[model samples]
Target: MTNQQDNIAALLQDMKSSVSEFEQTEDMGILQRIDADFQRFAQLVTLFLIAERDTYYGYFLMSMAFRTNYAVSTIAGIRLGEYPPVFETNPLILLKYSLKEILYIFCHEIDHVVFNHPAEMMKSNPEGNPELFELFNYAADASVNDMLNAEIKHGKKFMQAPKGVVTSKVIRNKFRLSHVQPLESYQYYFDLIKHHANMLGEPQQNGIAPIPSGSAENNASPNNNAIPGGVATSNAITAAGAAGNINDHAWTFATEHDEPASESAEAMAEAVKELLNEVDSMMDGEARGLMPARFSTAVARANKPPALNWKAILKKYVGTIAADKVKTRMRLNRRQPQRFDLSGTRESKTLKIVVAIDTSGSVSDKEIEQIFSEIFAIIARRSFELTVIECDEEIQRVYQLKSPKDLPNRVEGRGGTSFTPVIEYINKRRYFRDALLIYFTDGYGEASIPRPLTYRNLWVVLGNTSNLSVENPYGLALPLEE
Candidate 1:
């Protein structure tokens, strides 16, 4: 076996030996008892890590520090915000389950982290209403557990979910909710539950009532009676019953003592994001592919880049282009005002820009209109000797527009696309040699366009295509969103 595997096996054996030794001994000191509990908790975490190696959850578990917190009402809960995030659990409580069941609970808690429940709860319950926070926990748990249950049912995972865990199936059946869908956001479930609670006219202080032991709706397994957290009984759904307060979600909002958390909600959310990103980077392609689709979908949504402001980018690029200055003796120069005969000069600045429109079959009329609209807006903001060149395989039409009004009502050319023609057309003209070239196209043409050495060019690719996807040998490629 590999060194890491050998170490894990040795650790497992050591834990077993320690447990046997502790069981046989009758008396132990206070410190010894505490150490024993801590050791056992560490062993349980080690066991979980071994089972989930090379997986996202395994990476998360490796990164976290597991502590034994008997004060925590739940079997376990995670804390974020500070460096090296923590997972605290009641070791004595954890000892109640089989290895598979423990693994299930461990993954369940990780799912909460994966879904960013704590940060979300903080955002949704800013007022920190105890009742609303309770509701948020339920909704979050239902969403996560339903996903886990689905994965389990599909035989994609080996862990068996502990009995009486909060799931969408259980919540839907208990609340008579037929319209609720599976694997939805926690907010969806929260809204439905809150609305239903309000309609029932139940007092918020009393909390949602639990399922009675003898009720037909109480379909929980016989052995699965106790909820993960200490808030409710196995058969109840309220703060005093089964469904509410599954885990210590309040840690995201506050410390264990109910004091406010050290980090702001935004900071905590960012920390969770960074941690997830770190774990994501560590996962290989095969490991990522083995992950449930829900996880992949969530990761994609979380990591999606903010939309680019194409208009601002276009304006910025245009603003940086060099302007040609002309000197005329129409006005007095500030430097030499003493002699009237000494002809003072007036300065005039004009921007000469070439806008090449690809009138190929691939380029739509709407795209052309959008290109014109943006160009017209830019022209209105500044003085320019604007030259609009329409081209496909060759130059179709060229307009020297002095203003927006000078633009043609209709453009020509819808032949096959080739950037070579436009490059040649611009390079051959002495007047256009010094002007900045701006090409608007769908970027479906040849990748090996001839480089323009005379003047700088900018490729404003229209539609969803980005600069990286376009082929331009010289100058910047700016993507224009439609």
Candidate 2:
């Protein structure tokens, strides 16, 4: 095994153990700074992250928990799947906050994954609006804080959402949502906030705001957008005004965390995805039934993965896609037995294909249907092992199609917009070096500067995005008319 594999295996073993038992090699200074009691709290949450995903204890099995450094005052996300679970923590948080509050933070972190707030925010704001991100954190916290099933110490409640955060009651008051369900998904709250904001005549650029859409908040960027450090812009103060006691609880969850190394994060994410898929396999019947109806669907979807197999999506560009070989009648067969005819040397070539699809939110079903029909017409003349990829900003899924019927009935990701992910994905799959890459997208995303045209690339754009002026140094970018 290579160094990467060895490290990951070691990490997994550490994750499977209790936080107390797990070793601390790197962050000795920080760990030493944190109190032992807080370490126990971290261990409890870490164990929860890697808890045995069985029926009786299956509540957290679907939750993707990680034991990473809580460098800032908070913690969350997938990087915690590694060995020797390290829950993010700092001196002040451990000293000041109670275990019950820590539990609340833990539940809040998991809620982000369960509701997929990050992705939804990405879908809502593909441009990466900082204001919206802040709002999302607060709004998400509000939505999650009360919904958790945790109760710590003498029946005291775990969650105590700060006054700055908005709650369901806030939504009820703002939009007169008297009938809004008790346990609405985070998206519901986000939508409610967005719809209300638009009604108030705020700029609806991307058509959504943070918990309310933070990008629009005037106080969003204090350093650049403000007068040096003060809340100079109207947006900043606007954001601050919304936060009842904004300055007090300014620490956001998404921001407080560190950026994991891209390669390791992606690598671990895939591994965790597989492990979650396996755990999900056994989560049928009563175990499944126990989860909240709304929360259950997300896990169910993750586990079952839509039953739409493009040979298990090539079971990640992970399959061999055959293409019709360009052929000409020759007089000889060199490998087996020479076809002796005083004609020409005989040769056989196996062809392959690469198809990259833009599954960005803007691309419609009709677009998928229309584009695929025309593509099928083009490649139908030959026996090609087709590979299909559904992507948005990043590749959401990948699979190899054995036949035309192998077309997937469903797709993943309507989140944001990016083409670089597929480009990078293609670069790694060096084996398909000579395949014809037929890409389908809305033509609304970033592309490589000096385009990597190692493989023949073709872009089939749908909608008005076809009008977009894209400089293609590699191959053709044509509008799919009709």
Candidate 3:
């Protein structure tokens, strides 16, 4: 036998042994039927590897935790963030497809992870709005399928995407958007869909109807109970029905009453970085070159450092604050070790920061959430006093936050925006004299305001930096990325 054939045979045998061991330990009556389905899946994977030997070996290597689960919501799906990552499949559903189509679906799930779609979708729809999440899911599937089809056109035609699969063409035709490029970022597609939905005056203001509970669109947990003959339960069948349009985007966000298996956007990005590094280390030059450029580009973009290092900037400014020092007799002075009378000095490290949020009509809910999330993360890492001043044209509320949990569920303001009130309020307070003032705004207010003389000013402008930079003659103006 050829070396590749031998390798495949060894893999198949290993998988059979693992399944047999599982069967011996478990009391499930349908283990025999599951074993049959797993054998078929192994055969399909073998055929897939033989047909597209050069293209997806790296992906298979990266995804070592492949399993056959009859209860998987979709025909096939990948759950990332775990080491080796889990690739689960409903073999019964996959058995309906041709080997070529099966291969296409397998790669489709891998591409979703390779493109960092789940984390991006989660970041975009932080509120976990089911309809918006579905929109992102559609967009992500389209982008992946478009890229896969483009590759097929370039002569790697071992696999063919099944009919009715979500693609860029389908999305464009559905939305009547003829101008969108064949391949665009997931965000591009999502934004385009949202804009189109808004223009059409669709329900929910953001477009797309709210997904009802237990609906096919709702990514709730599947009923794992198999019929007497090992047929999928109702919930699993419902998910399988929507396989053409949705490939288990449940990994992107948490479902009601269930803890998320997925990581946060920041954590997921780090996981992707590690995955990419591992893939690169495993693949030789020829294999690496055979991989699509889009995959590499996506990885680079996803792993790219933020344009502005907010943490470093905050540290640079906050680190400059002088702390109160007191003499202690615990140790000798560094200046003169021989002088026993002198004591070591200990400096108290306590930071006081006054944050002014511009809760004007122009600032969006998403933007406000972003600002607060960032601020919470920054403060969570240090011992600091946070005084939040919510303002629009005037100060609406003042909060002294002892912890992130102490933050209010809602804030006042949403009228006009003005920075003067916040500045004047801080300047007039004796306690805020030593605190650094950070004004988080959309840079839409008066042309200029009286700068604070008692404290340092850090103007964090959302979206555009030009307005804040041009208007504010003093203090540092930093751009807060959307």
Candidate 4:
């Protein structure tokens, strides 16, 4: 046999063995129907996809992950392929759903890949709990489903609302969060679910219990890696080992198998750029409309903080906070590297930084998550005496985080928006003096400057509004694109 054929044979063998948990099906009828429906489904979704995102070209490159294994449980999942660069799925299970539902599910899978759910979650938690991982999946689905439903309502004829499960809109509204991009939204929901899991224990672990909604970021586990909620809906009930493991964060499975010889994250990024180029000429206003500016902003966010890097901004303002040059005692310290000048040392100062987040009704969970991630990154680098004030119309909770682990699990507040409360607290108290005030907000509320501004402020606004409507000539107003 030729080398190519031999390679194909070997790959097929590897797949067969890895997924050899169940009997290979001989149901030709189901296979034929899957093939037939997928073609029509693809045709319809192609229009919606184009209408949705021109950068979402990765959808066309996916192949089926459906091995005839009973372990996959009828929960249709898309696995990122590697060896042959395809998406793997179980077609038999998908056949049971309606054409609209099938189309929605397929589109949802594409959204998963396009948004880089698996990679992002892995980045967030490499050894994330399996049960928690599944809940993250549901949160992601809810975020995307909310976006899709929004577009459908706006006039996307081909798409429809997803059938079941909690939605991002519901989560955001119930908590009084603002509209953040999808990536942030997913994280926000995950945090909520994580809180739910703590109160009720993992839904699956308990069999079933209604999740309670509470406000505040205090529910965080000690490790600070916990994500919220899992799908305990009856739909999630399946045969043993069918739903996959916790690391099955997205289409790319973990315990089962991820794409073999699959494209690396860097390679996939390059391929997406090429794909975007290929489709650039075909895009029209209609397609562009489907790809709303908000959604585009969201996809952009999953990469790195867009347009403005919150990291760089933080550095510019606070990077040089504490520095003390002094002579070191190298001879006494055996652990110091011999190549280093251990004799010379500088003492790092403890920076007392005040982070005031707008937890108003308008601020979204995704927005909260994004802001929290940035703040946590700062804390992760070094110890900061962080004073976090969660405020809506008024302050809801306050956290004194000495270490990154001490960071709270969620943000609480859904009242009307305002900056006065946090600013007033910062100014009225001498304790907050010399503290760098970083206000994370959407810049939509009553931002009338506090008379005789007592401290330097950084107003970081989230969402489409590029500039805060209210003028703050005293401090820098950094507008973040959603």
Which scores better on TM-score, 1 or 2? 1
Candidates' C-alpha lDDT: 0.62, 0.46, 0.65, 0.51
Tens-digit lDDT string for candidate 2 (1-482): 33433443344334323222312222233333334444444445444433322222223433333332322322223333343212343222222223334445555555555555544555555454545554454456556654653222224342343222345665566456665554566666666565444333232111111222221332231231222221111222122112222212222223245543333333433443454445456566756565455455655554553332222222222233433333344544445345564344433244467777767676676666655565556555555556777888677888887554566665788887777777677777775676767777777665443355444666666655344445653665655553
Question: Over the stretch 368-479, how does candidate 3's per-residue lDDT look in tens digits?
Answer: 6666667767767667888889999889999887765566777788898888888788778777777778878888888878768645778787766886733554777777
- Clashes in candidate 2: how many? 31
Best by TM-score: 3
RMSD for each of the candidates: 12.1, 18.9, 11.5, 15.3
Off by over 4 Å in 1: 1-54, 198-247, 253-263, 305-482
For residue 366, give model 2's deviation from the true position in Å: 13
Rank ordering of all candidates by lDDT, starting from the highest: 3, 1, 4, 2
Worst 10 residues of 4 by lDDT: 206-215
Model 1, range 219-253, lDDT digits (tens) per residue?
22123233334322233222112222333566553
- TM-score per prediction, in order, is 0.48, 0.38, 0.57, 0.42
**Deviation in Å, model 4, residue 20 alpha carbon:** 22
User: Model 2 off-target regions past 4 Å?
Assistant: 1-37, 44-86, 149-165, 172-181, 195-296, 306-482
Candidate 3 off by > 4 Å: 1-58, 195-247, 252-263, 306-432, 438-482
* Number of the top lDDT candidate: 3
